[model samples]
Target chain A: MNNWYMLTLVGNDRTGIVAKVTRILQQNNCQLGEASMLRLGGNFTIMMMVNSELSSDDIITALQAISAELNLQVHLDEIEGRLHEHHIPNVLVTVIGADRGGIIAQVTEKLFNVGFDILNLDSDVAGTDERAIYIMRIEGQALDGIESIEAALQPLKADGIDISVQAIETLIA
Target chain B: MAIHPILTYPNQQLKQVSQPVDNFDHNLRAFIDELQETMHDGPGAVGIAAPQIGHAIRLVIVDVSNKKKIKHHGHLVLVNPEIVEWQGLAVGREGCLSVPDFTGNVVRAERIKLNAFDAYGEPLSFEMEGYEARALQHEIDHLDGLLFLDRLVSRRNDLFERKKR
Candidate 1:
């Protein structure tokens, strides 16, 4: 919680974004905490939470060079609070079905309705346009109200989607 | 006197096989008490092994009895244990007290008949199935220096290595 700042960078998805940004932060001696970059459609977007003694103006000045060079958009904001989360069950959910509108929408909605938090989700489409296959993986906590989120997903079968949910016990021997 | 700091992975001690406990002495009982307390203190921990606390002994404590899906209803102090028979394969997601932040799919035996001694040196055998059996197998694996990463279904698709903590 010391001199924390949130940085968001968006640009074309190609190469070297990580390399360039990390180098800048290293030069300024700033530490990167939680960072996420995702390619949405065709643009690559990055969100990084950082903590450092360096002032925001100093970090922003360094990143500005990369922003202009890479034709990227950058934003910097400071945070003045602590971040913490209660430990909860982490489950792996897989959904596969014909690529169609609302596959991600419907599955995620049901998971949320059943009190499961969707932490991360990634989906892809393959096969063919006439019968594209969509595969997705979601990991998150299942709140107390969820009797069995897997059972609630049974209705998705009507949409040609097959889903499976399993508890992630990564540390268990 | 109860809860101890659960060791995280990459800690060399977690990889070593534990030796069987032969003494039913006061110290052994005291260690078992600490293990139970540690397991209870862990957030949602169903079972734990001796090595997890840096104690290289064949001791494990499991009590999934209170878990809603599969409840057994008591503490299990297994010492110097052996799995005589096992059947069925069940793949479930699992995380560890030592390795927090990531979770993966693990395939474990659905049922097992385990022979072991109690903390007081009394011989005991257990017939476990479903969730309880899975938890027992996981704890026993710790005694043999096995982590769930060793039996992952598929590292590529079965892992949630990216953690947000």
Candidate 2:
């Protein structure tokens, strides 16, 4: 049995971000399980879940070396127990209003600050419509006693965005 | 007592129409036992149909009382149940034990008047509302060799592919 890990590395977009990144993984005997790498605003963002048979620190050290060479900000964490991924709550939040410069930054900053992980997201601002629609589903281990987290996101109301939260448990039914 | 493996889709048994029970005898009882046992053995299985277990009989056992949304439906063991009438339409995403890894939105009748025989071979007719009715119709569709994927209005953006675990 091997350890499973999730790594998120983001940095300036370059030609060899993948080759440099995965070379380290290969050296550490890590199998590339699942990964998605994309370019966003001139930066390369990678999200991957991998399986390994090595100690966590060994893998972290290997990635650290590559990160320094590539000038990438890399974060590695082990996928925890059931509470961390399996039983985590999932919520869908949608915002429909005039498209402005800070819509994504504002909405996502609030979500991240409140301890929500963007699991699967698809959003399009579209052409110059009077109102641009934004919809996203955030999945994460609910922050302990999420009532206050909910309160923090309430300020989005002033931006004229509609927000709703539904537990992923309900979706299983 | 016997517990049977539920036949997931891409298996022929899940798509075959089940035959109606012509008599209340040992075979019928045997089918009922196997259906219940199989459903209990499955994860989150609320119902099982004859075609799923290779019987090909129009029989299904449903007990959604263990589920969150339709526990109010109670425990039901139906043999050759028929939907005599239906009213209105309700839409909800549905999945099946036979199709282990996929779900789709399906529109079904909201309320239904049904008639069927109980496990004891006694005749029963009743009306079902809400989620209970939805679960009932889902199982019945299996009797006619229908899968929830067949009723989906359009292709889902994400069609989950199950890998051996």
Candidate 3:
């Protein structure tokens, strides 16, 4: 029987990180599952689901050599292997404005209050240091209908933030 | 007419380029009926292609009349369809009967004028815009062995997992 684990690795961004790590996993006879590997804030992070016959400790030990060599941090936790959980987003919300504190918090708070479940969110700061612009794109499900969700977020417009809510119609063609 | 099973992704047949329909006969009529039945059977299906039903032919059916508040040409049976002209580009999230697990944002023409033959082998030319145009492009893509997954705006950000209702 295979053991499932949620594995995470973080370290300074470098090339061949994925190649080295995956090669190690392959050598250990580890079967990889869903994984997201990306650079965030100059750090290369890998979050993946792994299935192996080895225990968590064994897996960690297997990765210990590369972890020490690359000065990377590796964490592993045994997890239930539930395949394929579907979560579809019904609405897309875009928020753009001058960089300010608590924009995400306030926007998320309103969504939480209205039972909106966010599936994915991406935010980035652009423009110059003196005039930074905060742009956030959110995909989520609005449990209470688009109108109510719009109303809940309408208050944020007063702060000079440009907010747009669009319904995602998934046409099966 | 019977509803045909839709061939999902990873089905090698869905990846092959479909052949053009040269002979429009009783058999073709029967197949079109089956395709229409299959489309109607699908949940929220607005268009369907021959390849989707494991028939590798350049035939597709599109109906946007059921969609509320959208200008549509009602039911369309496009045989050997080709886009003659198109204008504007817009991105919209699309799901497919073949790809049931996910939806993704795909850039499509906002307006398109296409020429195709009808079910009765009658030549037809029409223009479509907005949602209708998007649907037509998607269906036509199947003839060329392309899915919306192929035309995704961004593979990382545009693809979305679809929730089960």
Candidate 4:
């Protein structure tokens, strides 16, 4: 039986990182699964699920040459099951304002207290280094409905954070 | 008169362009009834297209009356529907019955002027805005074999995994 493993690689951003890493997996007969690969702050990060008959150590050994060639930090952990199971997101929350500390913490705390499970989140800084603007978009499911989620985030408005909550309804057409 | 099974992605039929409706006869009326029934059968489905049920015809049904505080044309059965004019642009999250596993943010026209035919082959023209316009645009796309995935605002970040209840 094939086993699932969470494989992660992080290093300085460079072209051909994906091509080289995926080629190694292909050569090793490792079946690729759901993956998220992106560049953040001059670093390329790859987090993916792989299914293979080989042991984790064997997979690591197979990747050793490419890892050293690209100077990438590679790590793998055996997982019991797949990690990309689908989840329907019910609410979309956007937070934008002057960059400051505790924005993520305070916003997440409000969501966590109400049993809201975040499915996807993306944050980025814009504007000049002298005046930076923090923008974050979070998609999640709110079991308690949008009104409650809105109420929970209402307090943040007082702090001059431009926040908006929208209900995400999927119309199948 | 029947609730047909929805054809999901990878069902190559969903990718083929649907033919324009030329005859609005007895068969067309019966098929329209089936489409309405199928739309009602889906979970929270406000619109549906003929191609979604494996029928490659230019036909769709939309009913946004159940939606609160939105102006809608009640029940709409558009035959050979086409958007003649559009205004503004907005990004909204959309999920499809054919692609149930994920939802994506798609850019759609905020307002639209549409021309279509009713079930009886009579010409109909109207204007729609807000959610109704978005729904119509999505249904019309099926006639051209375009899914929301094809129109995602940002492929890298707009697509999201949808949890099944």
lDDT of 1 at A30: 87
What DockQ do you compute for every candidate structure?
A: 0.26, 0.13, 0.52, 0.48
Q: Could you tell me the TM-score of candidate 2?
A: 0.61
Task: Give residue A26's lDDT in candidate 4 (0 to 100).
Answer: 91
Model 1: per-residue Cα lDDT over A1-173, one tens digit each:
37889999998887998899889898888888777777765889898888878787888888888888888898889986354442445677788777778778888888878889877777767687687888888878887533478777878866667777766543343
> Could you give candidate 4's per-residue lDDT for residues A93-113 as a string of tens digits?
888899999999999999998
lDDT of 2 by residue, B1-165 (tens): 888777777887778888878898886787788788888887776677788777788887777676555435578888889999998785555777777555555777878999999766899887987667788888898889888878886322222221111
Pairs of colliding residues, candidate 3: A87-B163, A88-B163
- Native contact fraction per model: 0.40, 0.00, 0.76, 0.69
Tens-digit lDDT track of model 4 for B48-90: 9999999999998999889887789999999999999999877
| lDDT tens readout by residue for model 1, B133-161 | 88888888889988876777863355333
TM-score of each: 0.71, 0.61, 0.92, 0.92
Candidates sorted on TM-score, descending = 3, 4, 1, 2
lDDT of 3 by residue, B1-165 (tens): 888889999898988899999998999999998999999898988999999999999999999898888889999999999999999887788889999877878888889999999877899999998889999999999999999888878734542322211
- Which candidate would rank higher by DockQ, 2 or 4? 4
Worst 10 residues of 4 chain A by lDDT: A80-89
Query: What stretches of model 4 exceed 4 Å from their correct place?
Result: B155-165
Better of 1 and 2 by lDDT: 1
Off by over 4 Å in 2: A1-90, A109-117, A126-128, A135-153, A167-173, B68-71, B85-91, B153-165
Deviation from native of the Cα of residue A71 in model 1, angstroms:
7.1
